[model samples]
Target: MDTQGIFDSSSTVRDCSTIFALSTLLSSVQIYNLKENVKEDDLQHLQLFTEYGKQLKKDNGKKPFQVLEFVIRDWQYDYDYAYGQSGGEELLAKRLEITEGMATELRELRQHIRSCFERVTCFLMPHPGFEVRKKSFAGEISKLDEEFKTALKELVPSILAPANLTPKLINGGRVTARDLFTYFKTYMTIFNSNTMPPIESIMKATSEAALLAAMQVARELYETRMARVTAGLSLPRPALQQEHVAALQAARAACIDKNKMASTKDVNESLARLTQELEALLPQYLLINDGNLQKALGEAKDAYEASVRRVHGADLLCVHPSDLQTIHNEAVAAALRVFDARRKQYPGIPDDNRTKLLESFLPRLDELNTLNNEHNRLFVADAKLSFMGEVERLLARDPPLGPYEFRNEYNRAKNRAVAAFKRRRNMPSTYYADVYEDDLLRSIENRYYIIREINRNT
Candidate 1:
């Protein structure tokens, strides 16, 4: 019977005096059911049910029934709208199947209430959108079709009959199984009505959704694979020594292949750019690994130290300008050899390391050049000073000689002083060339004349 027929029959039975108490009890039960069926559906009631359920669980040992009453009251307050205004109450009532009276154990009651809440939530919650579901899968697209079908089954009814669907099934206006089926049938009819057959539109939307989901999966896969490939490319691999460059090239080719198949521009562009960058950097990484760049740097430092020692020990004064020039050239050449050897051995060394290595040796080379110049100046000064001292000593003799004897004594003394001067200054005897010897002779004669004048005055 319909709700109204049941109500009328309950009223008629309530008027009888013979079974008055039982009739009143029956009437009260019917009225309660009717009230529960008539309340409006509100989404907020779900939260209320959850809160009351939690409170009921918490108070299980004390005043459990009171917490249960709160839960039931909250459920009825929100979900009463599930009872149909158009005779679908029977179906909703069957779906709920809630028994009257509380259970003896709070655990049983909690379970029952939780089950009720789950049914209501499942029936009322809107189906996730395509984008939302795609994200929820977290880039795993293997079971996308099955998942989408399940989601459609849950969401399509609401989309088709949103007006009839109620938030709470306990006391709300009910939507029946038959009603949902009928809506689906009608929707299919309209969907297929066009001549061009909006089937393409449906297919396109589905394809786009699948593509979006697949793109997420592809992006994640690409990233993980690229990370592995990048690590392999960046590190030294002795086993793969001969094939390292080829391996990198193959990896880049695979990335390009994946990029070509990418469903989204972002995925395609990202993979393409990553491959390009890896390709650009791979050569340098490989060169460093192959050349053992760190070892080369260590060797260069050793060469620099040896060159510094050689520069420090060399006798700058004894060396001719040409020999000093040769020594300086050799030191520079040795340093350049280190630099060139390192450049050849570890061409991929970063500019910063190269600059530091050059700095270590360049200053020592400049100091060697400066020392050679100073030695040249000192040698010339010592030679002239020795020539003056020898000439003065000869002129200060106890008995003055004639020009002939004086000439012989002066020549002998000049020769001996010149040889001693060369020895004292750490220079070769022949370091004073013919022109230098001529100038020294003229200087000695002029000094001898000055000494003779001093002797005559005495």
Candidate 2:
């Protein structure tokens, strides 16, 4: 027997020696007729004994006997299975090739092939049931001749339509640069492989197509938003607030960053240009609406009024009654004129310019009010001393006036001084009424002594 030849031919069938030995042992059991319907348990017991007999023969140095025993056992096993079956010869021929080792190898090979098909389908095709459809197409091609197989490979590009290659948003709606790069890298690998050239081209083309599609979609969305913002800008002041402008700016920045990963210059440049246009329009569209403008103006007016009130309150502590009133009126009138003019000017004012004007005007108004109040306070303090001196001078007359007339004159002058003091101090009319009467009596008595002295000296 050409044992070496047999082993080489059935290399996939490992442990062929066992099969050979088992076959020889089964052939020695010739008592079991090939045509007889034998019980399965009896055959099983007989096979076990055959193995024992083969081992014994091998131990006795009858190696040739062992080979013959294996061949006989194999033949009998085949005969028993094929007996009384349809197409027995064909069945035996097919079953003979399927050893335990060959079956295991075939199963493993099937699993590996399935994995490869799945990876190709997911990475390149990326559609529903694409693997199954591809497998079916492959089956059909395999049934055809060698020429048809060659043509299939050449015609695959036309036969298999490219999947819709729109970029998908992974991990929510945020598509990062990493996500896009990963997809691009996967397709690139397929493109560089030795697989079907048509499929590789499809993968490369789809990757590009998807990126472009994503850019277009993003462009349209951003453009629509920018259009709405521009339309809003066309309206009168107070229409757009700071938040609206901020949102537009954020959207523009996001669009730029998202599209920056695109492979093509045109896509990047186009997105950048759109963003630039949006940025340019941003200033123009940032018109403040009437409500927002009024709100800001109201705040400024409130601040101005509060400042004026504070200045007036501080001035009242020391300002001359007359000068304090004058300063207060002027400050109020000036603030009103400025605020009114601002309100009127707001009709056609750009938001930026309006903000600049307000920034300049409000702080100046506050400072002016503060300075004027200080000036009035100093003036009033000086005036109080001057009025006191004037009263004392009037009471020291050399020529004595009549008693009633002197009393009346002194009372009038004292009342006038009291009124001035009350006005300067921001006090009510009744605040020093009692004190004024007492001071008047005292002044009259003092005037009597002075008049008496003057008469005696004369």
Candidate 3:
């Protein structure tokens, strides 16, 4: 009778269903008859609905066996799946992200590594291959240098002896050591580079240059080794291939005793720089790649779950019929007991008093039997004639489920109220109630109208 109360209960039913819909895996809603043996598939659906309703009832301890509706929204991945496909889309995407990012970073580091190799190669040519120890040689000291000939060569040619001047001997075409000495006046005693700078010194410079070239070669080779090591370190957790062993071997070969031919400080500096670069970049490389992988996993969960949301159109979600039937059976048995007792008592009472007695007792008896049952089932459609319009509508409907024999009685009373209300523009509305109550009064009286009505002449 209370529209607001009815609407509130309906809203509660809707709320219970929405929460049930939040299940990531349930495929569809199925009304289950808890009394009948439900199929395994149907039981699964029923259990979900029951759990949702039970929790809500616990939260607000009001009612049970409520109607619940569920809606599922479908979704899928872009790269991991086609428009409506299914599979491990997120798993695939995560693998791609982690592996791909690491691979890209590995490629970037290789470029710098290659440049180092090229530089090392550039320095290798024209080094220890040429045995050019000629510059470090001292001049032929015994013959070329006539130690005390400074004054002696000066008398031979004052003209040739002049600074930056030279002369040759004429008698024997081959020049003597004395004549050679005379040709180079101060060069004989010039100390550092007298006649021509010694070949041995050039050889010394060549040896030093050759040594530095080898150091550069060694530096790059070790760097290449370090690059491979770093790449191996940065590889994704499960994607690591064998650490580039060849590169590692080459690095070990490149580590020469720099104290012999290269700067110890420079060798240490190169190793330090390599470590710094690896330390600075490795953490970021891992973090970004890992972050992308996690995001991919999350997307995958959503994609796989979308299938569950696609089916189960919204319609039947009521107290499962079986559960309802169980409650109904219990309520019916209890009501019949009361009705039976009252029926027996009605026959013993005087006729006029019996009608009033049954009317007074029937509604209360039905209410007692149904109150707990209605709460348990939380669904009801019994027509209570407590409202004016409702009584007329019930009269008009002649509802198929109502007792058929009571149809004429209900209609006769409904017609009388219609006739009475038509005159009530001037008459007070209370007059209609009087007429309505009087119609009920006659309906009750007609219950005892027996076989005597037929023969007015008799």
Candidate 4:
């Protein structure tokens, strides 16, 4: 059932038509009741509404109106006129024909309604009690004549026959129940104002609202996942990177899946906004990874120092140079391991962060090795000086002895110096120690010879 034409002089009729217009915004299938035949006034009113719908479609993306069915009621009363004795395509064509000049207005109206609503169907319905009046009425529908009961049954299914009963769509997204409230409120406000708002205003407001809702959903999911992934702010680079990737995938899927029934264009737009939001989040992760990696490098350096101290005491260069090299190698290896363990792996992110940090640390290890070399040189020098001092003290005498006695004194002093050098804990290699000892003894022997020459002259 519907209202009279919007142009009706009756204020109540116009008001009712306005209400009908509001219903059109939400309608998927509209059933128009006809007394016996299609009237020119009825077509004119429907055409006016169809024009309004077209305006809506122009302003918005698409129309919600899908099916329009005209039911000719009590058609059994005029069976010959209604069926035209053929009751097939011939009847329908003859009824809808506009060959007469009196129906010029109706021709235009029918054309307009057809353009607005693509799926148009008409059904001939008889009075429900007409069968009972014949005293042949049965309780069940199968007992009744196929006219009234069958027509009702067929009308219901036909109205619902569309494979997909699509809902209203704005922009590209499907209008949700929450959106319906806003839509009705907007339309009623304009309607109550006694003026219709422009289509642009309505479309813009509603479309933005729908798009925002979609974007919000995506952002919330993305944020939740990212927050969990970065909560401690200390994830390994690779682990954090993997989590970020997973978060992005899940966010996109959620946005698309949630709005799957929406227009493809609308869904894409929402996804685009989500992409932008994800882009904005990237800088934060970069900073975190950068700081984390630096901290890792520092920890690696500390580990290197600790390992060195644990394996080789403070006197690093006291052993053979090769042994010091071995200690340095072990410490450096341990430090590299520490750095590697701390390094994070980020997918699609550059490996330069880890690579650069590791590279920078290598120079520090080299510097440490140099420091050990210097320490070794000082230890060997100190040992040689102590040995020489001891030999000089042993050989010096107030009265110089003969050559054989001098030789024996020299050998005794030399043996004692060698023993003292060996007793020092932080000594260099034994081969190095022997080389220094021989040089010190040669110098002492010359002094002994001078002493002997002085004794002989006396």
Q: Rate the local accuracy (lDDT) of all candidates.
A: 0.42, 0.41, 0.32, 0.61
Better of 1 and 2 by TM-score: 1
Q: RMSD of each candidate?
A: 22.3, 25.1, 45.7, 12.2
Q: After superposition, how far is residue 453 of candidate 3 from its true place, in Å?
A: 26
lDDT of 3 by residue, 47-80 (tens): 4334433343344343222221111112122243
Least well predicted 10-residue stretch by lDDT in candidate 2: 118-127
Error of 3 at 258 (Å): 12
Q: 180, model 3: CA deviation in Å?
A: 47
Ranking by lDDT: 4, 1, 2, 3
What lDDT tens digits, residue by residue, belong to model 1 across residues 50-83? 3433443353321111111110111232233331
lDDT of 3: 0.32
Show the colliding residue pairs in model 4: 172-263, 237-344, 237-345, 238-344, 238-345
Q: Which stretches in model 4 have alpha-carbon errors above 4 Å? A: 1-214, 227-246, 311-317, 345-358, 398-458
- Could you give candidate 2's per-residue lDDT for residues 208-237 as a string of tens digits? 544544444454555566455444123334
Total clashing pairs in model 1: 12
The residue-by-residue lDDT of candidate 4 on 117-206, one tens digit each, is 746666777666545666556566655556667667766665565764656654445666766665666566556755554555444444
TM-score, ranked from best to worst: 4, 1, 2, 3
Can you give the lDDT of residue 28 in candidate 1? 12
